[model samples]
Target: MNKIKNIHILILLIFLISIGQMSQTIYVPSIFNIAKELKVNMEEVQKLMSGYLLCYGISQLIYGPISDKVGRKPVILVGMMIFILSTFLILFANSLELMIILFSIQGLGTGVGGVMARTLPRDIFLNYENLKKANGFLNMGILVSPLIAPLIGGIISNLFEWRMCFVFLLIIGILISTTIFIFLPETCTKKQIKNSIFGYKILIYKKKFNYYLLILTSGLSGIVVFESNSGVLLSEMGFSNIEVSILFILPIPSIFFGSWYIGFSKKSFNYLMWKSVILCLLSGFFMWLPGWFKIMKIWTILIPASLFFFSAGMLFPLATTGAMIPCKGSAGTAGALLGGIQNIGSSFIAFISTFLPKNGQFSIGMITFIIGVIIFLCWWKLSRLEKI
Candidate 1:
């Protein structure tokens, strides 16, 4: 019975962690539909993602501390309620501005998942090996959202309308919230740290943690920039919505492989970090080289982008575990900062990508290259420092 319960909890946590990414990506295939329906331009419609991401990232700062003070369950429940309400309300938003507002609110709600998913694993798994295994498994499951969400979004948008996408999210919100309310127990045992600032200071003071955080942020931002721009780029290349959705799935397998490899490999974290950084730099080179010669094709984009995704897959788990393991006592705060800062960085990059000239994939390639360079520099600095 205890084994069965553990399995159940793991499954639930997977769902909880997946909600944030699912919310972000499921409606992505509908961006063009949204722009046309709301009489907005591409830049304006992209705000829906940027707005949600900004609030999603920022709200974790609050949820993380509160979950530590209160319990994880209540904070999660409240966030789900907020997400459900906002998702339902978004279905009625006829203007881009209104939709952006509701989406941002929805982000605020889903942000709880971002904090708790990482924190709860720390709370439940006392052993480091067990925690690392759980995190790797959770990350593998999280990858499924991006794999399937755009496909679903494309099919729904093509058959019905984009608003139905929100309807689907509403249903999912109700089910997840209900399940959590019934089954999830409060996992935080040490809630004595009342001052959130102290927790922040503890984490921020660590040089290793700061370096890992920036490395994670830079790699993740490349993903956001690609996802933020890819649909429109593919559409311009004459692909239909469904086709674009299919193409989005192409790079995901590489990510899955990278995630799987990290679990079994005996390589030092530093070695793996360097390997991933090199792959990203190579990925960036491929991404940029094609655009430089005006020979950008579907394969050029997808194949090179897969290299980056593979690197990200490796980077996320390593960087997260490297940063979080040392701060186990302040799991909630550390989880919040880890998740929050990365999303906030990605949100900033995504917002900026919208303003870049839409020049046959040059913008995305350049952005990816730039991010790779940034990651390399951060990793070099981190490599010189002593491990925490």
Candidate 2:
């Protein structure tokens, strides 16, 4: 019965995490439609993503420490309510400014789930192997959002309107909130610390934690750079919203395969980490090569990008588990720092991509290559340190 109950908890946690992530990319296919309807430019529409990501990251900082003091369930419930309300209000937003504000608020609410989703696994699963399996399943499940969100958003926007995307999100928010209130239990059993900064200070001083954090951050930022730019780049290539959305699905399977492979294989984490680093470097080089030669076809982008995603699939679960293991005493704060900083890093990358030359293929490829280099250097540093 306890095992069955744990399975239920894992499923619910996956759902909670998915809703937060789906909110980020669900409107991607609707970017052009949103710009057309709102009388804004592409850059302005892109700000909506950056704005949401910024708040998503910032809100985690608050939710993490508070959830440590309070229980996970209440903090998550409050955040879901905020998300649902904001998503509903977004339907009525007629201007870009208002839309941005509401979307950011939506991100703020989802940030609760972000911190809790990761923290709960640590709280409930005491065994390192169990935690690793939980994280593997969690990440594989979360990857589904990116796979389908754009397709669903495109179909919805193509049939109805861009605002309908929020209608869908609002519904998801309500459902997730209901499940949390009914099903999720208080997983944080540790005595609450009076000063939240105590956790932060300890984690910040740990060399392994810092290195793992950078490895996670740089890898995720590369993906964000691709996601932030891909919609516009594909749209400009004369693909319809539906077609572009279909194309977005291409790289996801690689992620699934990578995650599954890592779970079943008996390879050492250090071996997998090195293999992922090599894949990332090669992925970056391929992503850049096609653009450098003036080839800008969709395949040119998708093929190499798929390789990058595959590398991420291998890297993310390992890095996340590595970063959190030592900080188990402060799981909530550690989760907040991990999720918050990565999102912020992605946001910064996305924001910077906006200023790059509009030759979408070249700019995106170059940025990805740079990100690959960053990951390599971080991994090199991490390899020299004591293994986690």
Candidate 3:
């Protein structure tokens, strides 16, 4: 609308969506190194992840509603600045105590860009099919970053130090901020939220919105429980950082399949959602198999995990697009609430998975199975309320 090319603005949005993951994934492989430098055990080292995720999830409650009021570009620009400043500060952390606090603050910045990034697609496309295609591209960016983040982090940490991950983030912040300032345009049609906290009631009160929110929560939680732990789990199985990084990339083919299915298939959103729910059940079963067998091959984890994430990745765009559909006035707030639920749900589940028995992978599988069943049952019951 601002006469900027849609392609340019869209590319910027996809990149911005990667912020939360890049913040954590790039440093995930370095958790052990961070523990060594900070003098802590692995269980305690995990709290850093929990702290960052908690802040990232909680801050989205504010980011979405505010974006609706202020317009999207300026909110993202300010967030980028906050992100850069916070990452720069982390470069100076000398103790685990200071690192935890800094990373928690970093999560605050993580909330800034994602709320608006998810909103802008609806702003631009304004049609369901086109939005799905746009969301496919958006989901691609989201999934691909995880594939690359750890690889990049592993290489950087191996060549330099874990702190270099922040250096990478600093450059990304500057670049994305510059892009938003120069090229990205405002996309909101109205500001309906009077108060951010109370605003969610308006959204949740919408028929089927809460169902979609619950679905988003369940979907992301499934993926994160495995993702947050996989790097460390693979490392414990005696693989090097590079090996874990490479194995993390195995899901790419399936994820691409899922994205492609959502973007190109003519199936109704209902059809897609049902397919995803079933996949979650199957994925959970397979995810549990690796730990059940007590086998340590990367393939044991990789094959089942790929199936689950493929469905998860496939569901990613659908869940987002569907959830925001009914809330026309508060797309920002809608996207924010959905994102917050997703991050908070996934973070909590992921953190809990790390603490579970049998070094967590077995519990990870059981939880994944249990959650998948719950999601299916919720959908089955809610589908009777009204068709999504």
Which has the greatest lDDT?
A: 2
Q: Give lDDT tens digits, candidate 2, residues 49-123.
A: 888888998899889888888778898989899899999999889999999899899989999877876788888
Give RMSD to native, each candidate. Answer: 1.9, 1.5, 2.2
Sorted on lDDT, best first, the list reads 2, 1, 3
Candidate that beats the other on lDDT, 1 or 2, i.e. the better one: 2
Q: Candidate 3 residues 1-388, lDDT tens each?
A: 5334667777878778787678877877787888888888766677677777777877888888888787777777777777788889999989888887888888888787567657777677766777778788788787777667888898899899989988988898788778778876677655443345577888878756777778778877776766677877777877777777777777878888888888898887778878988998898887787777765566667777788878877788887777766566677788888888777887788778767763636777788888788778767765676454
Task: Between candidates 1 and 3, name the one with more favorable lDDT.
Answer: 1
Task: Give candidate 1's total backbone clashes.
Answer: 0
Compose the digit string of candidate 1's lDDT tens values, residues 120-187. 87777766556666666677766667557888888988999888988888888899888888997777
Cα lDDT for residue 279, candidate 3: 91
Measured against the true structure, the TM-scores of the candidates, in listed sequence, are 0.95, 0.97, 0.93
Candidate 2 displacement at residue 149 in angstroms: 0.3
Clashes of 3: 0
Where is model 1 more than 4 Å wrong at Cα? 1-6, 190-195, 386-388
lDDT of each: 0.83, 0.84, 0.76
lDDT agreement of model 3 with the native: 0.76
